[model samples]
Target: MQPPAQVPPVPPPEEEPQELARFREEWKAELQRRRAATAATQASSSPPQPASSSESTLPASPPAKVFVPVSVSQPRAGPSKNVLPETHPALNGTERPTYVSPGLGNALSIYRQAVYAEQRSDLDEALLLYRQAFRLDPHVDRAYHREEMLASILQGQTAAVKKLTVSAATDEEVEQLASNLQNTLALSKPVSTGKAVVTGTLASLISGFPQELAFEPENELESVPIKMLPDELLVLVLKKLDPTSIERFARVNKKLRVLSLDSTIWRNLVSKTYRPPQIPDIEYMIPVIEKHLSDFRRVYIEQPRVRFDGVYIAICHYVRPGLSENSWVNISHLITYHRYLRFLPNGQVLSLLANEEHSPQQVIPLLKPSLRMKGFFLGNWHLEGTTLHLTNLIDASGRFVLQGLEPPSSAPIHSHLHHSSNTTSEDRARYVFVMSLNLRSRPLGRWNRLDMETYESISLETGDATPVALKHDRPFWFSKVRSYGLQV
Candidate 1:
């Protein structure tokens, strides 16, 4: 019976071989899938490698293990499973990696370039690039980047940090950047050379409180009221000022305006500054003075004619044609003569004349003798309206001769002398001048002095003899002199 049972030996179970074949096919399929996946990943992630000369002939080595996270129930040598949830959570079926669009990646690249340009101080290019990046990706991060740029500008940092990254930037990071920028700006500001000093008094004054007042009993000091000051006091203060200052004060208020415009103030000013030569009847000149009050201020204060003292010296130039250079044709030979006149307050006058050959010093000696004869002229002057009148002209030549001075020689003395005779009454009459006061009341104006011979001849021809109505010559301008003997 045993020999008959052993005859049918057990062939290996057919089911086991079938199961092994199925497992081998599944394993091969998994290996092929992994290889295809690895090749696709390499193609997408890496650039193509250049072929070497011996690469095609060389034998390939076994591929190194790439420790990628994967789940497998196969037995291994290690005790623990190779799980990498943090690195590749998708493999563990925990979490999938987030996908970023290509457009967003491009925008990020542009943002990085913009940051680099800004760091390089290329603001225009950086701004343009930033705008393009924002247009591509309108996200909160882009908005924050824009805000960061604005904060940089506000902090006075046109150049951004070189290593700044948009992905890592946060509100806290931006705030820190701004703080650092502010600190840098503060350091860059111009520092004062003066040392800083803090006093308790100054601190209290700035805070509007006394240092000890807080702890002391309440006792406030009374404040003085400036507006409550009397009008009389104000007027007194204004009266002490000059006309210009008074005018400025009048602009302060209506009350001061009325006070400054008071006629008495201007009248006082006129009397003090312009002592209009002691006239007999001052009442007659009052109306004239009142009418030209503004003119008086301009002539005296604004444009003062006289010096601090009361004297005026006039230098006159008489230009006329001389003997013709060419006898055949009439040609102008221009000649100029200078005449000096010194005026005093008591109606005294001194006269001198100069030529091209001599200065005033050289001419003074040649005319010294004449200085005794016609050296000085005496007259009484008065202002009628705005016209100056010189009357009672007396020849002091003979009177000085009686004082034991020899008579002047009749020979030509000065180069500009028109006569060779002793100083005559006709010559003396030329020193008397009747001047009209200009609106400026300056010493510059038209004047008519008697040319006795011409006046007599014209009177003899016209048969009028009405003091020979004299016409004023050219304008005679005079400068104010501090003293009578002063030379200009």
Candidate 2:
């Protein structure tokens, strides 16, 4: 047999538009059919308008249909205006994208539908409405709140970035705050004269909070660049700062913290008092963290950073928008590892119950380590909140207690402490999953007013409950954090 009818090798066929064009036509036909079916159903669903029999005489006015954004009830902060609308490319050699607003009615109509759905418990519909509202005006008031809630549930803290700085409320709070806003353009008002008086004369205060002056500039005290120092020296400096302060130093500069989230500092945080014989890098922190802490783990580091102490955690979800899922996963793992999770990536010192049974057990892992959930600090937690993540701090006492933080505006302003009652499970629900710390020191030396401006807080029974009770009153959350080998 002639081996086989030798057939010339077939050349690979060139791309063809025929099949592609055929698919396009098919899609178009299907879409048209769907529209036709929709129209037919609408026609059949409504009864014919009585054919205007006998040319009716009475004039009937159409109903007034009011329009509201879907997330109209969510909390909102500051003023927002349309910034970007469409996905237009940057003008210059920049990659930043611009938006093109498609007009109000077009977007507002969609928003109304979403709000309608939310009213009916249609979560998906509510989400769609928020997206539409964003399209109408990225800066829409309640639109931001609605969007944040969706993002928090869907994407967690990593996505709660822009939302945290703006909206933080349930529907009612949104309405009241919007009306209370004194200016549409300003997010915050000037420091009240009373506040200034209080903060200015804090030393004489009774010692309410651990410290109201959070590392203010002290003469030559200055923050230095991480790049300027040697890695060894850098490591040395980081060693001295307690884990809390080291985390704060990381956020002081995006580039700085981004570069510092390595094993050196994280490792030292997990260990048993690993102290560096010598220290370098005069200003800022980093070195202090390495020297004070021990052990390191990969799970504790990420772009949406978190730094912590035994009682508190600083959640840093300020990463730019449009992050990949993998990066976000690592960001979230810290929450699971630490266990006491804060929904938003905002950070705060958890008050450590040093004597609590569930307190942390020191483990040797990274040879440098900690974000101890249950531990002792100054005493017990009182209240905490913030507009942005407060990851920056200084815990000089080393009991994993927070030593540096500005007093809350109300702290010094109010001369007396306010009390809140939590008698049942419902009352305690708010504190269940939050990151916080309480400080305790026997009635050391009592003073009526510390430096005249700052007033001291006494006991919890006598402390002010207003700060912790009105959750919506403040634009912050008690952030949870994990560190080094503490990956749960």
Candidate 3:
């Protein structure tokens, strides 16, 4: 066959549009020229670099970054219209940014991390981090608190600020506010005190009711038995009811509401119930009632008293290092415990400390000195102003004595060494525990939280006192126990 007419190899069809190919080629050429010009400029203007010394003798500096245009092996056919070219110094090579190594460096940040560890019960880690933070900056805690306060402000959490403002108000401002509150209450059509809603002002509401102990029957034929009682007899009957009973009776009608708010009945209630029977009613306590400006209702509501129909509970947690099977791995166990305090009307208080395995429901019924739970102790308690004091602590059964803090100074030193000494263990275990706690309310009206201020073991024999550490202890919060009922 005649030699195939030489056919020129058909060129591969254009992989991309002609416009795109031409633009990409032009870009490549422009980049090459720019690089060449930059190199030339640097060579002409820059001083020659000195020869590096021996690597072992001189510390080597980090390699300087060279600006190089990236080349695409498979060139993009086209650029997306939505995507913008890199312009930020952080994104492109226009500027070299300083980089911090990945680690905790700021003291406030470290302190915050320590607080998180503490909340998680990682005690050891928390302690270490706390020390590190304090060592780095002694004021780290204040800094963290400032940051938190700023954040709260920015988040519109102004409750704390409002409280601060109220506390900081001048005496005149406070008086003015109180006057305003009274005027508002008096002018309002109705007043709600949770138990009852009274329509109109107290004065006007009472005016509509009969002043004398007489009631007009709803029906002409109906007989009202309560209308027969004289005002004096009626007051005596009301005074006999407890404060709670009187409040319930007040919800019956407007006449009963007026009788319930009587200064005399409330005054009698305050006198009878304010001080615990264990504590003598002192002359000074009278001034406390007078401080309410003769408003016995205010005194009755504001006076602090321990609740007997409930228990104060504290939940505590700690972290303990555990024995690990693997040497390289660390093991930790989170141990949770609870503390309970039940007060009896007789001034006897029962205390118990139990583990997480015991729920409150299971523990509440047994939270008496009679049950003799593992951590049970009995103590006498009394309230003074806003402080609750517990003293004369003895274990349940009243026979489990405590170890003496120290021997009496009058005793011979040799007697302590002799095993057969006349000194008995009972006499040596004569130390009494005394705890003072400050009472606070979580909400405005309820006196429900107890924060330990001081705890001491006083030796009756030696008269020496030793303070107990309360670092890890939490505040006790009151929880109502219906089983206890209204004992006090």
Candidate 4:
């Protein structure tokens, strides 16, 4: 039986190559299943690491490319996540990698809001939004912001431009913005070449609401053109503007500079806004008034100043003869003091002592000599043609003392004496000042004394007395001490 089974046992398992091949295939399938499970777990648990430079060449499909226009009018929902490392040759050799991230998307949204606000002339809100966008993502394109800034400047949003310039992170950025502005100005053309008639009532002439001359860019891709408004329109606009605004506009261009010098504009402005003190024969002084019209307007509306607002000095000589022989002698003395006279529009005046020395002292030695004490004089004044009439002089010298000096202990002697004296009301002293307009000299002009007065004096030699009047006409030279307002 063994011999008979030997034939079948001999082949017993002549190991089949097919069986070995099957086992190998089964092992490979199990290994692949384990690897796929591990890979799925890793992909769900963590984000994929960025490929190193060595792995850049690995066979992997690239992400879809996204092109964001430099100037986007509307906001996008979100940015992409797949960012490819690539250099943009067009963006000034910058690495304009796909900036698709949550932070960057929020930044773009904020930036879009800022652009809309700026377009509507809501500069404050626009600036705030722009700052917020940058804070969220500094990697946003600067050119977009630059374009918005240039647009604002072209629209004459000066306050906004100034604020943006101040907010710049570096001087280089400011310089770049300034350069862009200069380029825009260089390309600017006149707003309207046609001339329009300025016909209307004087009151209605400046009543038109200010029309904003904003620059309308042809498209989102083009630079905004600078606006050059017509001279007639400019004049009308300037008439409605305050002096400060007009002055600021004058610095924009040469055309504005010439337009700002229109005499009629200033004259009309002064006549409409200011009421000069009642002047007699004002028609005769038209030439003089026109010559100084600008200055007068500034003085009336901007700042009112008077001639008696500075220091003055005068020397006087007096002679007295004594009862004895060879007793006649002349005494000379110097008078120095500062007078601050502020003339208000309500016909009232404020006078103050601006000098360092309060007490008056004679420069020349004398005995029993009368001294004119220092005091402040107040009253009302009026303008008669080019002359100033100062009258109703009730001395209100009790206000202030000289700088660095204490106030007086008791009321001045003149206050009581003038009140008690039996002098007629007509005998009260009044001052008449005639102004000389010297256009070439500073301080505008000089105030000359048109009236003279006499004072009682006694000689120290023999106690003899006589009346001495100011002989030399000492016109008090003056300058503007400070500006005056209607209220003060």
Candidate 5:
């Protein structure tokens, strides 16, 4: 059958993001309409307006509907006692806060209820009520306060944690206000990214129906869609997403799960997320990617007949030149191994590889608030060669930190130039040069003068340096393969 006609890609308003954007707008308009109706009724009940008839529209904007946090426990009711005041301090205290009433009153009422729920610790009830308010009308706000509250709590908890251990900044109060900041920035981001949205009835998750198309900068779960993304931005988002979320998303929908299986996503994840100088074939890399992805559907890890890692790497070597079994494949790249493989959770298998670089190198390409990052590795390349990578190496908490060149180093170069020199001009120049070699910090980590097997600039600091790093990822495959081992 002929393929679908190619549509001339105009300036898409974020192709996949329309659903989310529409979803938010729909909510905002509804909130406004409800609030206006309530105000009209209130005016009718009061004395006639002055000749000018000014009190036209409420100054407040419509609020976004709150998302209910997903959890294992059933939702419960809020405390019966009222926690928040009926009105803000500036407003008339006697006026009963509009409770999603006929006009602007209803929009304000929902907002009041959301805040009140949090203060009373009626979290579940508040979330439920918040959603109810949003379902009735989603204007007045850009984000659903309850849902934002939930996501914020989780994010703050994770962000404030060090190695999963609680940090000093973590506190009960701080946790409560989680996801709140999303509201402040909602206006800045559109609702959709390639037609994904959170619209539909409350049972959308279970029903699996397509939600409305809208942009949601604060919707969490990678609100930015992959619409017309360049390789650079694509690599960055893939690198930072929480592994679990990507895995879960794959299981949620067939269309979305395939995104997690993108070849580039895995290639970068293994090369940068793990260590460098290790290049496994698409076939050999699939298992690890599938293992980590855990989506209901999985791609194969290797050719139908070749199951061994050695063969897989060897195959990739043929596909791209010198890849080997010892090459590292980050957990995400497992899909490269096969074209069709269904990977599910609870299945277990871990295949280990080797690196011999004793003189550890550090490569960090990106390190900033934004998702973009980069890094490099000069540890070991092809294991068959007589290289120093076979000698200097150590396993620090699963990450292969470079310990420096091995004694029987592969490179035949003398160690004379390797060590730091005296403060003389030549010596000082040498020190500065080596210090500057590091892709990360000049004083801390340094890069090797020679290119690694991939011919990408690999690093080898003076002494053993941890090789794990982050930097702006670039295409490092066009050049000839350089020997990564020391030539002393």
Candidate 6:
């Protein structure tokens, strides 16, 4: 069979109304009339010729009229004749044309175009526009952000907009308003007023949730079980949990956060951690809590307390001259050592200094006082503000000796050398060491750093106190020890 021939489609039966055709003709004639009138006005505005005998004899000629063609198919809202169209150079005479919107001559507008293009997934166009924007103004991003923020603020404040009427503001005026608003906001920061402010992504997300514990039923007909628990009972249950556990529980929901931030829990933990039987009252010892907005959570975070569930370690290094087989070049060795400090809740602290031969993993587990390791020292710590005072420091290893010191004599002439004639070797060896350290939170919330400020050794036999130098000491960083368990 032969292939079927193609059929021509019929056009619509609708015809142009006579009135519409007449309107179109009138519009065309009006455009022509306006164009002719414009040309006549230009001719009249031309400069007159100079009057001369030879020039006056010749008749004056009319000025030539220029009529530029206007495309009827183009949109009427396009750029005016005086505005130049934006164009980009072609690559290999094969690249497609990219049309940019008109009136985007400045950096801010170009940056906005770039952002719009990026949102539409036009990566190539966005990159090109971004380069153009930065080339024109380096701070276009900041200007754009400022304008956007001001626009949002104005849009939100209907009453203020009506009162101040900034709709007619120029670009410079808008910028000035934004700057003034920023300064005013900075100056009007909220005072503490004893109110605790919860900040962070999680806090903001849960802000609108109910403060009371909320439980959803598994079925529409079933009742929730946790909704019956009273706040007092819940608080008591939270009290039994450790600080870390309570924090983890609080992260479950907003209700738990409010319960975790209860003044009783944090206040009790703070008192138990800081106040001992020896120091019945710690008001003078710790910083004033009111300054921290009287918030127990803030006080717990900002207060400097020696942690017992971890070891504070300081690693030190120094260059030492090494013995060389050859007599030509002197060799220097870098010596490494670590100092460990473990504090107890009863005000006792264990300190030990070990060489690099014994790594932290090998030495930290053997840091107990019962082991009596070499260089192990037992001391008592007292806290006053950020400063920590360690006194009555004595050798626990029982191997330390004070060299180059003369023994006690029965004669009264050399009594200054020793406290008494009956001073034993053990008494002479038991030199009382005193160390002062400044405590600081490295990242401003965790109390995990200690800096050595002063060290002194007091002779029990001679009653002479000598200052010990800390030339090679480093700041101690806290490392949690699982064996020590939770502090509270």
Which lDDT value does model 3 have at 332?
A: 77
The per-prediction tally of clashing pairs is: 0, 92, 0, 1, 116, 1
lDDT of each: 0.36, 0.29, 0.53, 0.36, 0.27, 0.54
Candidate number with greatest lDDT:
6
TM-score attained by model 3: 0.44
Q: On residues 318-379, what C-alpha lDDT tens digit does candidate 1 reach at each position? A: 33444666788764433443344443333333333333333444333433223422233333
Candidate 1, superposed: residue stretches over 4 Å from native: 1-269, 272-280, 285-332, 339-341, 347-376, 396-472, 483-488
Tell me each candidate's TM-score.
Answer: 0.29, 0.18, 0.44, 0.28, 0.17, 0.48
2 versus 4: better lDDT goes to? 4
Q: Which stretches of candidate 2 lie over 4 Å from their true place?
A: 1-156, 160-357, 360-488
Worst 10 residues of 2 by lDDT: 65-74
Candidate 1: global Cα-lDDT? 0.36
TM-score of 5: 0.17
Q: Write the per-residue lDDT of candidate 5 for residues 1-488, one digit (tens) a residue.
A: 99999998688464434543554465456447645875886588678522321232322223332111100111122223322222222222222122122543465477667656545555677677667677666653432332333233333223322312221222332222111212221232222223121222312342453444223344576656654566456445754654444566556444454345554343332332221112222223323433423211121211111111111110010122334566574222111111011100111111112111111111111101110101111111111111212211111111111122111223221110112211121211000001011111113212111112211111121222223221211211111112211110
Candidate 6 residue lDDT tens string, 82-163: 3111211221123322212122338878887776666556667878988999998766665555344323322322222232
List runs of model 6 lying over 4 Å from the truth. 1-234, 277-294, 326-330, 400-430
How many steric clashes does model 2 contain? 92
**Residue-by-residue lDDT tens digits, candidate 4, 387-437:** 454433222332211121212334222221112222332332122111221
Candidate 3 lDDT tens digits, 292-410: 44455666667777877689997776677878889999987776677788877655666776666556766676565434334555556778878887755543321232223112334
